[model samples]
Target: MSGLRPASAGRGESGRYEAFDHLATMVAVLRAADGCCLFVNAAFEAALGLPRRALLRRGRLFDWFVDASALVTNYQAVVANQYSTVRLEALLRRPTAPHAEPLPVHVIVTQVDHGETILLELVEIEQQARQDRETRTLDQVRVTKELIRNLAHEIKNPLGGIRGAAQLLEMDLADATLTEYTQVIIHEADRLQALVDRLLAPHRRPHMVADVNIHEVLERVRSLVLAEFSRGLTIVRDYDASLPEFRGDREQLIQAVLNITHNAALALAERRQAGDARIVLRTRAARQVTIGRQRYRLALELHIEDNGPGVPPEIRDRIFFPLVSGREGGSGLGLTLAQDFIQQHQGLIECESEPGRTLFKIQIPLP
Candidate 1:
């Protein structure tokens, strides 16, 4: 009877452990003193790529982070404040590939067991961030394109009439001094005509969809920028060789990519002692991207990054709108047109900026 009793207790313990191990969501238990993880479910192990054995002996929960000391201090404060839950970003280094880029994580930390232990749950951030960016870019493109189309139409008829009236006055007027006023009217009309033409150009052109190779488009833009700014700037290519050809208008795509690269080059040109003024053209393949609430099988991601003084905060939010420029004497229609072209091809363009590093990402469907 005593031997049977011991066997029954052992089986019960094993059954309970197995039940928690097979849970759908990730869960972990840690020691309160130093935050060493004592138990981790299978889901937790798969998400973090950390085994139970390794985490069980950890000195602190933040020890596995690339920036461990800072993370620990920040987290300790959050817990000490008696906060029930806290959320923040954490960069965790992989055990095998410590030197590689740290994994970006959205962490949720909560106090458990009467503030004795802390529970940390992490979700990858890149995918969510990309989606948010795409949504914003698409919205901007749609709104800007509509505005450009409407404004161009509204200005075209009036501009033509003004120019015609100026010509008539110049022909009939006798006073030489009055001729200058008519000439001014004619010149202003011509300037507005030019702006209107640029605004209408994207919509007026017919799209020629072809099996376009994105790298080729990027390479062409790189060569053109290098030819003009070759004196003090360098363009770097970091393309993913395996990226497949996407169906898009070749000429329009080239124009779109060129506009972004050209803007970056111009920004770099205005800096003093801009060490290694560089624009990096990079490509990657993305999966499960949602556009307009519809999920895509594959998407082509092209990034144009620069190390220039970042975009001005004043006009950053309205950068895609026509006539909004950060530089003095700059026509801001370049990005507006670029956005229009990419949107026509069912793609999105987004920008992230900070001092010394700015990234513009273009994503298009791969089919």
Candidate 2:
């Protein structure tokens, strides 16, 4: 074992490394010679499903991985000054429960101060994949929103001209039958105008921000859906009363939730006739959650689940894309608008669907 080194003050103080605990990635400082752990952050402890004291007492960090050969070789190389940094993929063992599997991680190692120890960072493989997916999703959403807005503006300009021309033609028409044709043109043009307005609604409306009680929003959505699907539809509420209110746009949240619940009710049409339709609105508070690219200490998790046919596999990945629908006569803007509004509040919406069980989960950061 390497001899213990005394703290030299300033940056060498043990407290200095405490800031690493706030990071989402697992981190550890190790003695390169024998792989003894000198420091392990909160994320490292949580990822290993062990207490910080326990991990520190265990003495060596090499045993944490399923296979330590690769790590051992790299640690030695860094210790011998063969390389300044190294990265490899490994499976980290979890000893928390029976039959638990090891977690796949991308390991990064770099020499620390004095060259006696090295800093090790473990990035969860799933987290890296999620980060990539979020980046792509955000990029796509930005491009789609811009394209839709520009297209809507182009349509809106022509729409007014069409309606005005139709009105003028109706007034000058000598034959009553020809007036009917003009009226048809005017009516169709008005319908198209309304459609365009709906498409531009998110961009046009101002965000009315206020202190919002999420439960209140759910309650409002619950009542609206219940009233619409009064017969054979059971709306169950499973709420965590301890959840605190946060700043948000209350009306936008209400509409976002209402859209999902309404879609759930519509999907349960077959079960509604059999008198066994069910929709669940469940809420709880989650801690240390990563939403999109940022991590939050606390967030509100709201789940809208239904007992109905699952989303079609072909369109499941595109549900949040504008004008993508799985149901007949669906305008396909409900989920898209819901996503837009949730994103405005710096939150995320995810859906998991399977036969007889479809769940839409919304996570919003809380103060």
Candidate 3:
């Protein structure tokens, strides 16, 4: 926190720094002159359960809240250089949620060092602490994705040369004895190439958009999984018949669900031997769900639950990382790819695991 400056305060209007992106307190920087939001932290997103893009569309801070006349009054006063701070209580309305109640909050409006930039802080009287922590983890996930994308590119570049060298060596080897060595080299190289391919698959593939039926995707994965472990596992379906269609890439979604289900099946290996392995594919619709910053009126919730020896706590925090797998001989790219695909659709994926039960939840908004 040392030697860091506020984006709205010290810098000129040309470019603002995002100094508060990781904060636990809900804070949004708005242009006091026009009352337009310039920046918002993760806590703000959690507190309001609204997307930044949606907020930007609204064009004003007070427009999305209930009884926000005080906010407007404070904004005008701050922009006019009449007040440095203002505090009040207000009811925050969540219009997207069906039959939602007004959220009670303590609102504080303060002027930054820069003129006309008011920082609106909201303290949700009910669930401030929990919401702050969860949303802050989400913010870290976003940052982690950027780092993963850059690092994956770096790791993939040399794979081609290594594979090619192994191929050329195999071709040039004349003696059968030496050919076996080259064959081993070629085999290992190809394996690495395949692994690298999975790592790069999400970023390399083009996003194809179409009206996606999530049930169809699930059914496909279920069939494939059943066919592979035909006798050992029980895959159950618990889908909502009323789920509407949403726009997404069908193939990508299929692959994402498949990876998750397949991972569950593998984890249930010991349980399968016990003759009681079960994996349930449950689907429901959440009326008001927020993912990354977007609040959806309705989002499909897909739960892939398995009764296996749960994910080890040591690797739970890093399960989605590019190469962090729990099972032996696992590539560890499954969850990473699933996460990438979900994020592409303005969605989110979360997991909860304990002994004898592991649930992987996928939430994708219906457009």
Candidate 4:
């Protein structure tokens, strides 16, 4: 509770509670005697699917729970100095549109100000699981990147030596027919060298900085992808006109987007033959987005959605890993490069796929 103190009130009590609004976790403050709601943070309010005024009008925070008996008994115990903190699982009722089911949550209630004020935090069980999963994924990706970078460096020098030796052998060969074998060795070595370069490209390239218009980047990707798949692929632009320009490497963004869009086009091969392949490039401004561990007040959301057979269930999770591909003959570095580029801007990329639709979502913070 050291830095958790409410801000000093200048205009009103609600103004003092503004400090809690920045937190990604749901928080509520209530009077301990009767469990009357005093303040609800942005996350809490959003979870309850109600405005602050409406929530306060309802009064008791306990009423929002499906079974208030557990909370009520715990609240009384905490207020009576029986305990300083209590943690339990509960089902919270949301009466707003789009929330059709009771939300399962982990609730933490702590006595503050000598048990006069109660601090309550509610973490959605699903949200907590998602955060945990994302944390694990990020950690795994970091370890994988480090290993790949080190392995690529180890292979790089030997690769050049192998190609040079093969070239020298070919030049000194007595029989022209035998030179074919050396040529094969040189060609294969060059191919492996190229593969190693792709693996190391993101680490080697400096992050160039400039103001980037996301729409322009998408349009560039759209045109490039359409050029390759000229006949049946349709790239639809659904741009948010009010989105602000952000500082980033314009070329990197373009290439990242191009990679994703090109993959979507390739996935639509069967649909392309039918002349109905479609991809949507949608952009919007996202609020209160938690990317990685940091929460951003505003961020850009770019979704590249395609109407193709979704990513294979077997390889879906590893799509961003180097050399893991759902498509045949895929080099599998596209999504990996895209992820690395977006991460260089302190952003993240996620994919959601089903039978008929696959969406690649990218999030970058805005000023």
Candidate 5:
């Protein structure tokens, strides 16, 4: 309350001052009753690329926002009703920046009465990073799943027919050389059948939603990785033990996590140095995350970080697409399937890779 002061008046005239600061991704501020800037934090300045003096002269906070009218209306309501806190999101525009994009911000406004004027605090939503990732992952999964279903159905019938014809040809063949050709046809058909089976596996199965302890799944993946690469690679765990159980298909989640972790292990396997091949599993809890444009109360964040050489830069953007692989012999379906499973649980999977570091982050909402 004491921090509220008119912009025309100096800071010393504001009397005994109290500052409220919250750590958030973007800029934030506490404003006076007249909508003058009282306290503007460093994040706000950095995000807008503006100095505190410029912000102070800007007068009402709404003036800088892209849709200032709506914000002003909400603020006025708070003032009239003595509302203690209100949350909203809006597009913000810089005064003279033409090349900058309109930034989406989640704002939290609070009314405080320290003395003669009302005070309001603003918090920008940086948590949107996770939300954006969740949205893109969901979209990718949906499209990939549909493609797999269609492709599998199209190839499966023809593959069976070809295999049956090859077997019949083998039975009718008199020459041994002719039978060898039939065997080759049968072998290739079998390989195609196997690929189709993998493509349809997720849909053919049913999902069993149960309260699952994520740590247990991570532990199982860890054990499996160690057993496969016991000699050289290392699997590290950075778990938050207090994480609550979330409703999910246990086996599906396990497989989804395994696919990602296994791919990392394989990437590490090709590295020359033994100790340099390291995979770290980290987990945390996040709040107010949006997936598929729908907001959720809480979500679990899982990160699989590796120290091996990162994904190739060329195909990085399309890695989640069907049949995209960085490895020579890889089937490229592992991540696609993993993404599908996670999307079924209303979650997402995202990756960021650079030389010597690659991070795959999975976020699933918790009930």
Candidate 6:
């Protein structure tokens, strides 16, 4: 919890936790002496689904909480300069969803600046559980990445020796038929070496960053996909032209899109062998989008959607895992690498699949 910085009373964080928009905890700063609201962070606004304009207009800072009397008492305690901190679980209402149930939150109130101002923190009960699940998933991914890197290195160590031995054996064999067996061994070794290299690739290379035009990347992928699947598939474009450029690795983004598009094309081909296969490349600006716990004001959404047989039920949950493949002879590293690249940009990839329809949605925050 060393990374946890206390939000200041007067105006949340005193420049410390001010930029901690990623925390799911809703926080606000208030004028302690008068019980007036001061500043509210992104998480708070997103949690309640209310704009700052509406929140501040609702009345006192603590008015959003259900037990107004409890908040009043808490504020009194702060103003009196008796206790430095207070905590309680409270039901918090949202102006946007008035008819719905109030959000259950664990609230914290603290006096700072010699009781001149108060800091309030609200952590949603359900969001905490969601965060825990996300943390567990991330930890599993970390462990898997390490495992892939280590295993790839282990396989690589003896790989060169095996391939070299096979080559030498091939040269020694006078019988062409027997030499063909040695050639098979060499070919397989080379294939394994290539796979191992791909497994180790992300760790070996440093990310290249530049201002990326998403449409340009999409266009490149579109052209490549069309060239490959010229006759069978129909690729449709649905783009929001107003989106702005953001910094990222252009090559990485291209690869991510390519891998997803390529997979969609394959799936489409399998489901509809007689043509009428359709794949859609969609781009849109997502406003006030929350990825995991963090809320971004603006984000880019790139969707590669296809009409195909849905993901196989058994492997659906493990689709992004390294070496898990739906298609026969599929490397299975495409989605894994695609996921890794997007995560490098503080982005996420989500999938939705059903009979005759499969969609892969990639989201990255736009600065």
Worst 10 residues of 3 by lDDT: 1-10
lDDT by residue (1-367, candidate 3, tens digit) is 2232455656743236355655445677777667877777655665567776675677776877767777787778867878777788888777567378888888877777567467787877764544464476577667777787677678667766776787787778787678787777768867876776676678788999999888899999999999998867999999998998988999999988999999999899988888789999999987545566555567889999999999999998788777789998887888988888888887778888999999998888886
Candidate 5 lDDT tens digits, 239-306: 99989998889999999999999999888876625556888999999765566786666789999999
Q: lDDT of model 5 at residue 323?
A: 81
| Model 2 misplacement above 4 A | 1-14
* Alpha-carbon TM-score of each model against the true structure: 0.68, 0.90, 0.62, 0.93, 0.70, 0.70
- Output the worst ten-in-a-row residue range by lDDT, candidate 2: 1-10
RMSD (Cα, Å) of candidate 6? 5.5
Error of 4 at 166 (Å): 1.2
The best candidate in terms of TM-score = 4
lDDT of 6: 0.82
Candidate 1 deviates by what RMSD?
9.2
What local lDDT does model 1 show for residue 20?
41
Runs of candidate 3 exceeding 4 Å displacement: 1-157, 163-176
Better of 1 and 3 by TM-score: 1
Displacement of residue 186 (Cα, Å) in model 2 is 1.6
What is the C-alpha lDDT profile of model 6 across 150-191, one tens digit per residue? 899899989899999988888888888898788888899999
Winner on TM-score (4 vs 6): 4
Candidate 3 overall Cα lDDT vs. reference? 0.78
Off by over 4 Å in 6: 1-24, 29-39, 46-50, 60-94, 97-106, 111-118, 124-134, 174-176, 203-208, 226-240, 268-317, 343-367
lDDT of 4 by residue, 1-367 (tens): 5234546746565776788889878899888777888889888777777888888898888888889899889888888889888999999888684457898999998987666788898988988887886777677789889999999999999988999999988889889999889989988988999999999998888888999899889888887888899998888989999999999999999999899999999999999999999999999998777888989999999999999999999998888888888888999899988998998888888899998899999999999
